[model samples]
Each structure stands twice: as structure tokens, then as C-alpha cells.
Target: MRTVADALHDRHRDQLKRSQLQAHPLLTGCAPWVIRRVAAVADEVLFPPGELLAEQGRTPGWFLLIRSGVAEVARNGALLGVVGAGDHYGEVPLLGRGAHPATVRAITPVHAWVIGAQRFVPLVDDVRPIRETLAASLAAQPALVAAARAELASRIQSMRREGSNTWPGIRPPRRRRSVRVLHVLAAIAMFVAVAVGAAAMYHPPYAVIRPGPVVDVANDIEISGAAVHPIHGRYLLVMVHTERPTLLSFATAAILGHHRPVEHVTALGGQPDVERQLHGQFTKSQQDAALAAAAALGIRPSASGALPFTVRFRDRDVVGPSGGLVYALAIEDMLSGADHAHGRTVAATGAIDPAGDVIPVGFVDDKAIAAQRAGAQVLVSPTSEVYLAADSGVRVVGASSLREALDRLAASN
Candidate 1:
């Protein structure tokens, strides 16, 4: 009599063969389209002897239907039974009740139809018979599993004695040593993949500060409640980008020497919402920049309230007080009726107070690099951070306050 395997071999299409040979009770009386849907995502998996099909206490990721060979199912080291051709497993765990109660390991070379949980779970909900069959199987699992294991184990023994690799009707395929080599290579690849995945998911304790956009604040700022004048110079605001270090990025940066690492506490400032906090700081910096500009212009706030002049930085992505000095200079230059930049590009980075003091900010070196790359001829920074500027091919001018920075820029002119 021709076996399922022989019939499968006769078919030209592998999917048609799988559809017939790997038939489960769930597909019984189901529509042809339903069967075709399952077949679409089904994959044929081969397991070497001693390979685990599923582990106890672990959630099943695939539903397996045995097409050939035998596997031993065990719970806590005790063999519950054996499963062979036409036997199916993994429904219970996929149902979300609990993890696999038993471990299933291939005792002989195995070929099975495997459907991943991502695809299988939806079918259980959409297909009635599949859900019903799995539910029935789950309800009578204990007694049914015991009886099925005994019968399949005896049948497997008979097939083994007959020198067949599969069930009674199927002829065994010729075995080769290369199958073992393929299995070894697959195992090594899996281990390497897992190691790489784990490393990628692991977050390091540091971040990197890299050169970011160099924005010309002169043209980008919106000032109202004051007479706005046309500007001829660029006051660039230098920004530094920070990123959480990954294994690959860290290694690449180490080799490149293009970015510098900083401790998490320093980079994040211990804020869960660092971006939001920085944006807030930027908002305050704009206010301070406005006040500092007014102080430099000798425009004192009224006794009732500060000057009604409003300063709004256009680039919403800029999220720090590093542009405070630059913003102040832009406002002062625009309100002063003359361009301090003199049609030249000048970059500046520092925090500022309403009193016009230029407070040093971190990432000065990175900002200097950004300034140079943006073709800025001069970078005005806090006196304290001027030494931090590397050999960036740009002139660095140190200033302790807005008034001093203005004087320095004038002197440069």
C-alpha cells in the first residue's frame, strides 16, 4: 500500500504534499480555503535526534504537526509518551492557558509542519474547527495524552524494527553525514544570532555627544513688541546631539574617534524626560536672552513690568540653553540697528542669565566642531569653556558676559 510519504513524493508541489500529509483533526471538515490559509504560512522544519521540539515551562512559539519520525514527550524527566507521524503538539501553550507542561524531544530524525505563534494564534480565533479541536484536546489532555503516547510509542517501535524512518507506510530516505554538519552549522548560527541580539538589547551606562546642526539664529528668531530691523550677519547656534551608546555605535565611535562618551548621569541629568526639561530650559533661555540683550542695549524694564519685547526661537528642535549667548547676540544685533557679524558667520554657545552673564555649557568641543563645519569664522563661548574648544580651525573668543561678548565681537571686526 502506498503511504502518505509516497503520495507526497508523487506530488509536484510541496505545499499540496504538506496539505495532505500533515493533516490534523482541526482541518477535518474545514473549508478548502481554511486549509489553504494554514498552508500559506506553514513551514517544514527538520529536527535532528535529541533536538527539543518544545521545552517544559516555556511558552510554545510554534505549533508542530509531525510528518515523519518519532519524538519522546517527557514531564520533569519522566517519559509520558512518544509522538510520530500525524501527531500534533503545542496547541495548549498557544491557547494562553499556560506554558508547555512537558518537553518534546526528537528521538529520531524528525520532519514536521511548523506554524509560528504570530500566524497560528489568529487562525485559532478565526477558524472554528481549529479552536474547537484544541479546546477538546485541552479538556481531555491528561488521559488522552497517556493513551496516545502508549499507542504511538508501540507503533514507533514497530516502524523502527521494520527499518523505516517514518510511519509504517513510508519508505525511509537515504541518510547522509552532511545532515549532521548542517545541523551543527545551524546551531552555531543560532548561538551567534542570540549573542548579537542580547548585546543590541543591552543598554550601556554611557551616551555619546556628537556634533549636531549649526543653526543660524539671526534669520531664525522671531522678535515682536520691538522695532525689528533687517540683519546682514549670521549668529549660528551650535547644537550637540546625544545618544544612548549601543555596542555597535560605541565600537564604531571608538574606532572613528568622532564622538565622545559621557556618563548617563551627565548626559541625561537624571531626568526621565530630558527632552522636555531641555525644551523648558530653552524657553527660559530665550527669556533670559531677551533680558540680557535689553541689559546690553541699556534698555531697562519698566517699573511696572519688564520690557514688552518678546523673543521666540524658530527651531523647536533645539532643546537646551546652549544657544542663550547666541540668542542674546542675535537680539542685540537686530535691536542695535547694525549687524555685529558684518555679513560674516559667528557661532556662540553658552547659557545666559538675565544679568547678561555668559554661563559655560558642556559639549563646547563638539559645538566648536559644528561651528567650524558650518563655515563660521568665529565662535563666542563662555570664558571658562573657551579652553575646551579643540583645534577646530575656527577662532574662539571668550566672554564672561553679554556686554563683554559684544565688545569682543566688535574688537574682532
Candidate 2:
């Protein structure tokens, strides 16, 4: 541990990895240290010519950097433009607070570095050189994303204009038929059917927002392996879901706080889009949870699992990455032996990067109210609005990352 040779060896290894990233134009401007940091966590993936990389209208899950070869960006059968080595897509959708605009496919043998959603913001948001470099790259290829989205919008519009949707055995009424009487007759029936169907089966647009249980990870998890189980105490993670609202639901949410998905079925193109968002958010939550836990315990993430590494999210409406920080903290607590939460009722809100930086989220005011109502004694939130809940009669602490949040809670304990 005390040898000069050990320090030199580590630096050499880091430099070697940094050199691997230098081959890509997008990362060329990034300092060796930045490249080293990025290369450490990035997983490289290869795609053969003609392989689909990402699809249109789908939620974005990864930020890809083209290490070599070329890729095509298209929408509704129209080619928008081509992205070659150094050019990339997906970052706009990755952190721009929306779904992907178009489909992407490789045109030649390609090597790319995939950055999971959890790491996107934490890795690049505050990094000026990387962020600015990416911004410029995206700016240069505006048509790739912009034209594809315009094409999709035009296609959806065309579909509506063409009126090709002919219901089986149902035809348009003739002009002389005088359908006024028929329309009046069917109005009440249509309303009743739609109302009953949505009420009984479909969830509404209004989100049910409130604070949930403060579960003690060690006590709540049923881990079979002999893991370290580091963190402790009760975690107060809030629950937010969009559902079909009845008259009573509004009243309930008024007492509980309220929110909804910005991109609903109509605006987002439909259920598949929503499902894509859910899959990306939930999957990132699990992966980042494992990564954050490993970082805290000073162990490899794969090592945290005595057997194979696996975790699952059962919630169907987890629509976004807002709960990332909470998931990471929970995983950390479950895997380490130290009691970080210290048996205190703690709640936090933020989007966690794979690197563990906590990104701010919307609805801080509403979330704070919900947290206060949920019996949370300590609320950890992004540094920007930690004081947003100070007036809510709860102890509010600001944290810029997962480690800071844990440290605040642990220090209090």
C-alpha cells in the first residue's frame, strides 16, 4: 500500500483507458481525467451494419457515443440525416424531459459506448467541456432529430386527414340521411359506455401523489445471501401515479397533493410510448441502485450479489427516473453493514445518475407537502430547493449527491 510503484501503475492503467476514449471525436476535447472517469463506468457495445439501435417515439434509455462507423437517423420511412463517427443522438431525449423523436440504425460495423440514463445527467450536466461539446455536435446535426420529429408529426396528421380508419360494417352516413336524430339518440349511450369503461378499466390522467411508507431496508428486504447490508433506518420515498380520477379522487388528492404525466396517451403517441418510459425509468432505478450501493460499500457492483445480480420493480406506473435517488439509497442500505439511516424517518427526492449526482426534479413544493404529511422527520432533497420544505414544518436538508444525503442522515443519527 505504501509503494511508489503501485501509484505509478494505477496512473498508467487509467491513462491507457483514457487513450481508448481519445479515438472518438466527441470525446477528443475531453481532458484525459474526464475520459478516464467516463471510461471507468462506460460499457462498450458493438452493432453490425443494418442493426436497429433505437426506435422512434420510444423513451430514451441510453446516451450513445459513436466510437467508430456510421449510423442513419430516420422517421416514418424518410431519411433525416446520417450520424457518423463522433456524431451521436439520444441526449436530447435522455435529459430533455421527453421521449425520443426518431429511429436510429447503424449503417456500418460500429462500436459505441452506452451510457445508461442514470449516468447521463450526473456525468455531463455540470461538465462544461463535455456538455458544450455535445451541444455543438447536436447543433450541427439539427435535421437528424428535428426533421425526423417533423416527419412523424406530419405522418400522424396525414393519418388523421386520410380517414382510412373504416370500422368494420360501419360506414359514413349519406348527406340526405339527416343524422341529427341518430346523433342525439346515440349521445347518451356513447357517454355511458365511455364513462363506465374508463371508470372500471382505464386509469385517468390525474396523478395520485403522496408520501408512502418509510421502510427500513435491512428489515424490509429478504436477502438470502450474506451481504454486508451497510445502510439503515427508515426511508420515506414518495409515490406518484397517474390514474383515472373520479369525483372522490380529486378530493382525496386535494388532501394528498396532485400531479400528472406531461406526455399522455394522445400527446405521446399512445400506450407503447408510456410503457417505454416506464421500462427505462424502472430499469435504470434498479441498475443505479446496485451501482450506488457498491460505491458506498467500496466493492464492485457485481460483487454485491452473492449469486447473480438481479432486481425487479413491480410498480406499473413508475413512469420516470424521479425515484432514482431513493432506489440507490435503498440498495446501498441493503448491501452495506453500516446503519446510514440510523433508524430515523428519512425521505429524499432527486434523479440519481449512475455516478450518484442528484439532479433536481419538478414539483418540489407539492412533494414537500406530501413528505410532511407522510410523517417524515427528515427530508433530503436537491441542494437548490432543500429550503423549499423548511416552511413545511419538517427538517429539510440539501444534498447534491447520494453520498451527501446519506451522510446528512447518518450524521444526524
- Largest TM-score belongs to which candidate? 1
lDDT for model 1 comes to: 0.75
**Where does the lowest 10-residue lDDT sum fall in candidate 1?**
265-274
Report, for every candidate in turn, its global Cα lDDT versus the true structure.
0.75, 0.63
Which pairs clash in model 1? Answer: none
Clashes per candidate (backbone, < 3 Å): 0, 14
Per-model TM values vs. the true structure: 0.50, 0.48
Q: After superposition, how far is residue 169 of candidate 1 from its true place, in Å?
A: 73
Give the per-residue lDDT of model 1 (tens digit) for 132-223: 88888877776544544444455557767787544666677987755588889999999999978876777676667788888777767888
Residue 129 displacement (Å), model 2: 7.2
Q: Model 1 Cα displacement at 247 (Å)?
A: 1.7
lDDT, candidate 2, at 32: 70
Task: Compare the candidates by lDDT and give the number of the best one.
Answer: 1
